[model samples]
Target: MLYDAIRFQAFHQDMRIAMIGVKGVPAAMTTGGGIERHVEQLAPRLAGLGHEVTVYVRHYANPRGTKRWNGCTLVTLPTIRRKYLEAIVHVFLSTLHALRQKYDIIHYHGVGPSTLSWIPRVFAPRCRVVITFHSRDQFHEKWNIIARAYLAWGEWTAVRFPHATIAVSHVIQQFCIKLFGVKPFFIPNGVEIPSASIGSDRMKTLGLEPGRYFLGLGRLIPHKAFDDAIRAFRNVPTAMSLAIAGAPGYDMRYAEELYALAELDPRVRLLGFRTGEDLQQLLAHCYAYVCPSRSEGLSIAVLEAMSHGKVVLMSNIPENLELIDHSGMSYEVGNIQDLTRLFTFAAREPALLRERGERARHIVKLHFSWDSIVRQTDSVYESLKA
Candidate 1:
């Protein structure tokens, strides 16, 4: 709907944009994460706007070959697929490749990849370099001390090297100002409301009774804290099931722990990696959506849930609090007892939860329109040329 409101001629002609950092477009659609989803949504739309868009994707990730996607070109590069080396290796190669291209805007995603953003700044002096600070990656628990230190350094490079910077949330913009003494442009992530009906076929296959399960979606990472949500659900004395829909992200031990926990309770269902219609149906028909993250940069999962008109129960982190006010309930971050009590209250009072769900939808519709995000991002690219 947002696309319908914008004029196609607003985009500048013959402008070239090279997006590095994400795995790829169609590949990102399969592996559901914030950065991945952001690329999948924005890249094709940017190509549709008459810009020459080229994305550097990993060879293994983009299995469908290097075919052009929706007018955008995909350049597959090689990378060692190990957890620590994957991003570093891929980004290094991608940055080197981007330096040789005739691009107007070279945009990088995440602070880690932004560490190399200065490559284009020094080599391709005529091309403007841009980086989107998606999150405070240094705070993620999975990284080692050395990697954490490097990510912190990456944050420093991101603010200084780029011609213009974009922060996905206001919290991240404030973070840039407080830490780096620079204020970056704020352009939050956006989500489309699902148009598909809540079909009962997938529900029956998953042994789910429509609206009887609480939904948790996103990558199964330690920082996400889905374990706390599971523990909290155990305390709630209800017949409702807890369905977690996600895939593990290189943390085998954590995944093992989660699988073990799921086995303890028959009510807990570990629905690994639901996408497309299955994912949309789960979001469309759920008792409530739970997010127990310790850190976030405008969670796309939370936004998608809100867009689906589902009640959200999240932690009191600054990023989550920005999107949810009295419209949804929150507990102390990492406090199991507090979250447990909140879940019990929500399960018991379904009517009250539905009221909040309506408010959540209204909040997303007013604030996080994808059309507005695209237009704002286009303006940022145009300003660089000016």
Candidate 2:
């Protein structure tokens, strides 16, 4: 779609881009990792513009060893499968691999991965090293003290080492300016605004009624705070169901915890991970979507919910607020009472949510389209080249 405007912007040879630190591209609905989804949306569009895009994917994530997906070249590399060591180790090896290849730009996608941003700069002198600071992973409860310290160093080094930095949320952009004194290019996460419902067949399969069940979707991790959503729902005392659609992350314990929690309430349904069409149908037919994440790098989950004309009931975190801009409802972050009250209000006043859902869809259409994001990212590349 972007290529139709300029055809090809590069006057000389097309720019080569190497993307590091994502789990894998052609992001399936199962993984649902934001960075992978972002790359999946971005890489193919970049490739459409006649640029050579190489994405380094994890061996375990890219199990089939896909050489290519859509238009981008997929490079699968090996790494230990441990939760703590997985990201940094893969990023280290990715940088070493990128050193031998001739590329115009090497983009690292996370705070931990950005620690290796300097490596490409040192070895590949002519290549521009770019880092995207999505969120400070150091604060996540899952990380150990040593990992937290290392991630903090990554946030520090990413700003200094990379030729340019991109912040995925306005909150992150402000943080970079205030703490690091470097103003990062603001390129928030993007989504496609669905024109029509793809039908609710999947919802029926899960025994959910159309426009009845509240939806929660994301990786089942501590930071996602799905437990809070469940707790808040318990306080609501409604006939409406709570359907959480997600696969567990490295930790299966959280999933087990959620299964146990769901046992307490018949209305709560843990649907596990829904495929693409199934997820789309769920988004289309839900009562409202809830995203009570404690931390985010500009959540793709929130944007997708908005994109589907669904009113999102999310925590009042800066990043979440920044996306909705009052288009959706919010409760105090991590406050069970506040969330419970909102859920009660939602159950009583479905009409209010219907009104807000229209506004939420409008907001996404006006600001968060993927085509606009690609143009902005391309401009960032242009600046780096000059």
Q: Candidate 2: where are CA atoms >4 Å away? A: 1-13
Candidate 2 lDDT over 1-386, as tens digits, reads 58655553533246899999898876784654889889889989888877899999988778888898888898899987788888888989988989998999999998889888888888899999888888888888788899899999989887999999999988999998999899999998899887584877667789899889999988888999999999989989788999998999877899899999999999999998876788888898899999999988888888999888788899998888898877788999999999999988888987888888888889989988898898788778877887
TM-score of 1: 0.96
- Model 1 score (lDDT): 0.87
Worst 10 residues of 2 by lDDT: 4-13
Looking at model 1, residue 169 earns an lDDT score of: 89
lDDT of model 2 at position 107: 92
Q: What is the C-alpha lDDT of each candidate?
A: 0.87, 0.87
lDDT (Cα) of model 2 = 0.87
